[model samples]
Target: IQQKEHPKFKRKGDDLFVEHTLSITEALCGFQFILTHLDNRQLLVKSQPGEVVKPDSFKAINDEGMPMYQRPIMRGKLYIHFTVDFPDSLSLDQSKALEAVLPPKMTAQISEMELD
Candidate 1:
């Protein structure tokens, strides 16, 4: 039987793939959102407290995909592909604040030129 195309999900061998976009703040901080399944069920999706989701990262949900063929009770995996959106520019104060909270910047060393 041919499966109908879902607006937010792509099916591949019973597995479901969905792309989710997040802001820079949400990528660094934690985030929570609801996802609607094929059966019109709402799923609460969230990141761990210390979990930092990078760009193009994937999160898999067990048994949340399309039902297995023949075995109606069993299901595949639901994968969420995440993409982070960054701001166009940051002010000097914002940069300094981020620098203070984030890791220290690496300094490049310059060697003195020898006299010709």
Candidate 2:
């Protein structure tokens, strides 16, 4: 039987992939959300403390994908692809705060000829 396309999930064999968008703050800090599975199950998805999810990163939930053929109890993996949504612009105070908390910026020296 062919699988129907889901609004939030893409299936390849038994594996499922879903894209989740997170705010910039959520990516750097922590985030939690409920994911509705194909079986209509509500899964609580969250990031660990101090665990930063970079853009285009992926996380997986074991045995949470489609049920394996001939094995209804067994399932494949569910992958969550994370996308970070950054603000178009940051306020001066916000920028300063980020700079203070993040790693120090690297300085580079350029000659005047390089500017030309």
For all candidates in order, the CA lDDT equals: 0.93, 0.94
For candidate 1, give the lDDT.
Answer: 0.93
Candidate 2 local distance difference test against the native? 0.94
Model 1: CA > 4 A from native: 112-116
Cα TM-score per model? 0.90, 0.91
lDDT of 1 by residue, 1-116 (tens): 76688788999998999999999999999999999888889999999998999999999999998889899899999999999999999999999999999989899766676432
Residue pairs with backbone atoms closer than 3 Å in model 2 (clashes)? none
Mind sharing the TM-score for model 2? 0.91
Residue 107, candidate 2: Cα error in Å is 0.7
